[model samples]
Target: MIEHRITSRSVGALGSSGVDMSFLLGPAVSSINTVRILAGGGLGEHPAETWQVFYVLSGLVEVTGSDDTHDAPRTIVLEPEQAVQWAPGEQRSSRALVDSLVVLIEATEQIPSARPL
Candidate 1:
């Protein structure tokens, strides 16, 4: 069995902005189809065709979609045990309102393309 504490060393910073992501599972582990972990702060803009699941471990977060910049689309406040999912091609971003912990699950493979009409 694999077991370890979530430490600073295990955590990583994503993109040019946002929080540190603690990877509980990586590509090396074939059993885990996604990357699981704890994250904080804003996770910038997401890349196209990437699926993500965010689970709140503690505190709160604000998620905004880039599609609607005229006004606030919606804010999802996630507490401990709460979770949310994002599909491919969705333009979204997240930020920690308070010092928080979150589990981010992302698919290891790219989303398949659909046939042209």
Candidate 2:
């Protein structure tokens, strides 16, 4: 078993403006992170290579994205307790509409088929 304690001071940068994210210790096949964003901060344009989920814990957020066949972008607003998911190859970005805390969960491409945890 693995155990970790995450506090506000322990989170790290996510390369996005106004956003800090920290990975929770566990899961060899996926990533679990806590993300904090200040108002007006956001993640820039990026392509999804694996399944990803975002759950809002507080405040408001705007998620924008486009699928492979769609040239137009779709935007969604998420308030506290709301969630969103992205599929592989989907282009997406997110911004904090207000100060917010979010949880990010995603599956890595190279997941181990057999492993003991």
Candidate 3:
């Protein structure tokens, strides 16, 4: 079994934007992670082929994205206790409006469909 304390875990670079993140659960276990973004920091935008979830733990953040049908991007501000899920094929990105803590969970899972003979 794997166990970790969020506060005890050290923060590391998330992406090119200089955001900090702690892996409460790494991708090896599952794509579950907790992230902290300092003011003006953000995760770069990307398109997802599968659904993903983000839960706001504290502070404020602005989520912006555009779907396949919409050429314009919509912005949503999330505060503590608020959560947002993005659909597959949607472009998404997040920025810390203030110092923020968020938990990210990727719903996609890769399980072997068949066993080798």
Candidate 4:
């Protein structure tokens, strides 16, 4: 069987992501990563590269995004088992309310609601 240590990719320096990011599935239809954020640390004051989903794996996080369909910004407090999605070109940002781990998924194509882990 093939084995991939997805989280080990974050052993080095943090990338431009602002948070600690480790790539999993990538350069194909979509890319998946694990983001580790310390309390008070965060990611982005930038637009989403594509359709993106932030699924909280542990701890609590505050996510805010701007949508073209709405005048006011959207904000969510994501807890474990909770997630949020952003459309392409939307402004997205996330802040860690506590030390947290999040599964980040990004794709230009549609993402199925459920998939084998």
| Model 4 RMSD in angstroms | 11.1
Give the Cα error of residue 18 in candidate 3, in Å: 38
Local lDDT at 92 for model 2: 85
C-alpha RMSD (angstroms) for model 3: 12.8
For all candidates, the clash counts are: 0, 0, 0, 0
Point out the higher-scoring one by lDDT: 1 or 3. 3
Q: Which numbered prediction scores highest in lDDT against the true structure?
A: 4
* List of clashing residue pairs for candidate 3: none
Worst 10 residues of 3 by lDDT: 1-10
lDDT of 3 by residue, 24-45 (tens): 3224224768999999999989
Q: How do all models score by TM-score?
A: 0.48, 0.63, 0.61, 0.69
Residue range with the least summed lDDT across 10 consecutive positions in model 4: 1-10
Candidate 2 — which residues are off by over 4 angstroms? Answer: 1-29, 68-71, 108-117
lDDT of 2 by residue, 74-99 (tens): 78788875665666777788999899
Query: Global lDDT for candidate 2?
Result: 0.66
Give a tens-digit lDDT track for model 4, residues 1-117. 001123422344444443554343334347778999999999977988777778788999999887555687878788876666666877778899999999988887535452322
lDDT of 2 at 87: 68
Candidate 4 deviant stretches above 4 angstroms: 1-29, 114-117
Task: Give the whole-model CA lDDT for all candidates, comma-separated.
Answer: 0.49, 0.66, 0.64, 0.69
List candidate 3 stretches off by more than 4 Å. Answer: 1-30, 67-71, 109-117
